[model samples]
Target: MPAPPIDARSQNARVLGVELCGDDGALLRIMPLEPVGLLRAGRFFMLRRVDGTGPYIPRPFSVYRQYDDGSIEFLIKVMGPGTRSLAQSSTGTELVCVGPLGNGFPELEAGTPKVMVAGGIGSAPFYLLIQQALAGRHGASLAPEDLTLIYGGRKAGFLYDLEAFMDLGVRVLAATDDGSAGFHGNVLDCLHKQWEVGNLPQTVHLLTCGPEPMMEAVAHEAAAKNLECWVSLETYMGCGVGICNGCSLATRPDGPLGAWPVAKACVDGPVFSTSAIEF
Candidate 1:
């Protein structure tokens, strides 16, 4: 099948609403007046507030949810000037956004056992993927029982959208490093326990996004089981269109005869098969 066309637009999007997640953080629901194609799961946008009260460069955010009303959501953690400004903005604020950029998770085959692993805000993109699967979009239909989500965070309060996913009928397993939640360890431990208990299928596909170290650990586990894994990467992007080449990441070449190639995460991918990446 042909690859989906890139859908990047620079528009003034309104802050329709904001749901506070934890202290000093929020989940923003924004709507672009222009009609946009359904943003695939794992894609992101480069957002800059119109007021320009923050940093000059726009920040990249994974699409948390793309609603039918031409609205999209972003899960933001207050970390810097850009995000702080976004978090404090009230409804009706306008944000200049350029995207629906980057590749998304591949459409899974029918009846494939799947596990989605997320670390903190990394859960942003999976919600749309789950929604698509449940709605049978992209010719991929996933039964509720066939999907499991293993989400980890520093504490129970850090795990966002947990109940929302549960309401969608996907089974959820959680872990917190501080032992303040479901499991007493990291999500890797959760995966291990699930495998040990025969809850994990012999053949499984993994979709994950998180800190690089966490994703790397998941990659190693997937490799050990000979499972196919797709990971969504987070990187600093200067230009969401790949013109500045600032989001380049080292990636294994597509063919066998060359050294690892450099791929622009902004354009080449944010979601890549684990085998195609070196780290």
Candidate 2:
């Protein structure tokens, strides 16, 4: 999904040294990815390669950070043309990024627990959110509340670190589409089993992101429990800002007129509350 390339005029709006509250990127020059904030697990950022001439298409990626030094990272699965280019980038190839955009999960009440459900790359955003929540950002604290993050991937290799999330005082539950990881079922099934066994604690907010199917499934569970849930959406967005209408989606039937759920993936959001979104 190519967004219109940045025009000559667009170049004038460029800012220097984005002043990252958290700066982290890898591949020195090739594939540099970092978090923009004390990223909330359900938070996201607009991503676009800085070196470009065409409509600079922007996409949303989840945050991957677990530290307190304001460093954010992402789990990038190289499966596309854009990313392939970034993966092949040389050292110090700084990318042009826009925003710690979109609405993120708000502070959970002190007594409220948190349950994170992630799918593949979707888990990336939550990684930071979980970190921040546990760190007590925005008057949000997990001190008295329990934290559980359910992570899913295609297989064992796609899976990364449950220990890290656990280290943040989060109880991690892992699953794979295949029976290749901790659970022999999907994340939904894992959540179901927890539900069946009454393992999910009350006063827990659920945050989820990843493949559309997994998110839809998670949505079902959140609805079942009348729980507050947040979601990050991935779309082929062009124009990191809303100027171009590249990555857009159809709003739900209950949406406002002309309410294209397709907000600028760059400007509007890479992250949205499950209820506020049409998805």
Candidate 3:
């Protein structure tokens, strides 16, 4: 398995600000004491307040966006004490940040179109992916037309930072369980409709991050269509490093990761080819 980046280390960070997003989510921004250079889109960090306000164990969060000034953002759902503490943090609140962990998304192939499916807060990583892809930073440069984002949420209120994603200049489709926004169904239904209408090609690269059930469904769909797909698992991590083994995922017997019975999401990947691990 791969190891954490050599630059990964625990350091102090100070809250820049926290902006409320969607109904129960927040965009928490912090400036790390040390510069972390540029990180791949799907790489993540473990964060916890230095004060005794949240869980003793730090929570793993995907890098939402990184700024030139050594600041990073995390799109967080305020569902638990750990998240709640981060959301309520004021400017200058001290935090422990450990990261640039795990392998990020694989290089994008040229010519093939890419369709990203995101559910709720899972949309976090795609912003940077789209940004990098358009700039030709990830791999072959892709035009805005070559990329599409299908974002879904239980309700419109759950589609956090929808406007910011739309501003990225790529086609952004919204799917809500209720008919509060864009399409009136889940992301899978939205995807099928797009295919049926010929809005998207039959063969395209698929990337998804979301609730386990949603990713599983998307994986099965991609398999049925014989399309390549990758999933960024939102697995819980006790320690965002190989030592804890808290984020182990069972490997597929016939897949690329078959050499090992299991893989660590923190070091090996939070992103994995659908074929490498069983849903």
**Alpha-carbon RMSD to native, per candidate:** 2.5, 6.6, 0.9
- The most accurate candidate by TM-score is 3
Q: TM-score for all predictions?
A: 0.94, 0.74, 0.98
Candidate 1: the clashing residue pairs are none
lDDT values, one for every candidate? 0.84, 0.58, 0.93
- Candidate that beats the other on TM-score, 1 or 2, i.e. the better one: 1
Model 1: residues with Cα > 4 Å off, grouped in runs: 1-6, 254-260
Task: List candidate 2 segments past 4 Å from native.
Answer: 1-41, 48-58, 66-72, 252-266
**Model 2: per-residue Cα lDDT over 257-277, one tens digit each:** 244444454444555556655
* CA lDDT, candidate 2, residue 247: 53
Q: Which model, 1 or 3, shows the larger TM-score?
A: 3
Model 3 alpha-carbon drift over 4 Å, by segment: none
Clashes of each: 0, 16, 0
What tens digits encode model 3's per-residue C-alpha lDDT throughout 15-103? Answer: 99999999999999999998997888899999999998899899989888888888999999987999999999989999999987878
Residue 234 in candidate 2, Cα distance off native in Å: 1.2
